[model samples]
Target: MLIPSAQTGLQKALLAIIAAGGVAPAEGADDSYIIEEIRAVGPGCPPGTFDFDAEGQHFVYDEMILWHPDPAGRTVQYTNCLTTIAIDVAEGIQVSVAHARARGHATLDPGIVARHTMKFFFAGDPSGAMSHTELTGPFDDDYDLSGQLSPGGEAWSTCGEPVVLGIDSSLQLNASHNPAGTAELSVDRLDMKIQARRC
Candidate 1:
């Protein structure tokens, strides 16, 4: 009997889930979307921790969830594309589309848009199947930082107060923009708790 490797098994599982129709475009979607969940289990790797090829900007995980917005007003759903999820120990998280069919296609890379001086924390728990993330930066007056967790979840706050939104089984809280675009807001901070399941 031919046994599947751990990586292969995980990939098969992810593909199955994707085929089940979990991915869809968010309502009134835009050009970009954020990562909603990430989960993985493989040999030689911890439950929540996945292998990261820094030079290639590739991430290998058992499973992951992404919030994709359809500019054409289609339904929002999870994606299984080979995307890039980059995180800096001292910096913030950057989710980019490595393929055209994936979410955030043609969108600005969060890493590029994010200010280097920002401070944040991002981590996942395989045991609990959840990820906790937080970040803070200076509010940009030129562009509006408002966003939504899901299709119709809620508008992300640009005020110095914590703005919270629910993405799948995760909760994201952001407080780093000035609605009025007047003061030099501190981009208070954004916190998120994402839950994922092993396939």
Candidate 2:
């Protein structure tokens, strides 16, 4: 129930953008993307408890990227890149990652890791009065698969630290408007640049 009580200006702006069919890539451009930026007032779950204020705090989803290309020309990707949840507080914030399985997916055992499992949901009141969305996942941030077999049985490996395999995170947003609206989001920014060539 960590949803926003009211629709912030940022939400409205984002709704407008989506309603307008979202941004499109430039004609014949090598790459294209969209950014959703907004500020809103909401409660923050900082470690233990949730807090709110009369003067809404600032929240930004600057990581909302609609689409981008893999520099290696492997494939076209569409993703909601990243997000930043900010609340007005006097001290620094400490956030921790939970080790669990994503919804609608198999549970994570002790030794096995989840490479990339995510679950997102958006719901609204039947009367279209309020709406909210949530995103959760358990991705393995330390699962390495270098020198792994490709789908086509070829040698294809990535050179890097163990990226997300199975990880877990939770975020919820509820608005007192447009209960029928739907939204999708990602937890944080992911660096997808190719560091080495087929390492």
Candidate 3:
């Protein structure tokens, strides 16, 4: 993870915390279409809490950043590719974490004011090969995010804020991107219950 040039330890602290937080993009303007944004919730440890010094572990990852200027003077666009390979505190610590990548973009009012949406993508859940963990596919859409879903029940709702599906099951996390373009999605938690475990 690339450390942000934030002033003050507390500011840096919060940025680190939010690095793994599940904050979605807030509402936007009339013509705006959120390509992607922060996750409202998920299971990856807080975004910026990588060092885990308190836990006595350290991990490093790769991040790709692209900056493109648009014709319009109002917004400067950017594309960010985040790739992470984590090393559990195995020798002394025990943390079964996963690697993740987020290749997304944003058109923003740059410099001091950042209005952007950042999407996240897993390499694919470690248990994805299993039948029980139908965690979804590349850009998993098994859980729907858009409020208005198609009645055909093509997929399940995963936006966390659940709707009754006859049975009461807490929602799950699913990743998706625009079929037409890129997007940013914020996920808060991915709670997995592996009762009958399989590799």
Best by lDDT: 1
**Candidate 3 C-alpha error for residue 107, in Å:** 13
Judging by TM-score against the true structure, name the best candidate.
3
For candidate 1, write residues 35-139 as lDDT tens digits.
322332222123443433323223433333222132333322222222212211111222311111011111111221221111111112111011222223332
Q: What is the TM-score of each candidate against the true structure?
A: 0.17, 0.16, 0.18
> Which candidate, 1 or 3, would have the higher TM-score against the true structure?
3
Question: Which digits, one per residue and each the tens of the lDDT, describe model 2 over residues 1-199?
Answer: 1222232433443334334442222121111111122122122122222221222121223332211122433222233211122111112221111111222122222222222222111111011111122222222232211111112222211232221111112233221132232223233222211111223
Cα deviation at 9, candidate 2, in Å, is 1.1
For candidate 3, what is the TM-score?
0.18
List, residue by residue over 1-199, the lDDT tens digit for candidate 3: 1111212322233244345643333321211111122221112233553221211112221222222232333232333222222211112222221222222222322121222222221222211110111121223122211111112212222232211111001112222121223222222222221011011
Clash number for each model: 11, 14, 30
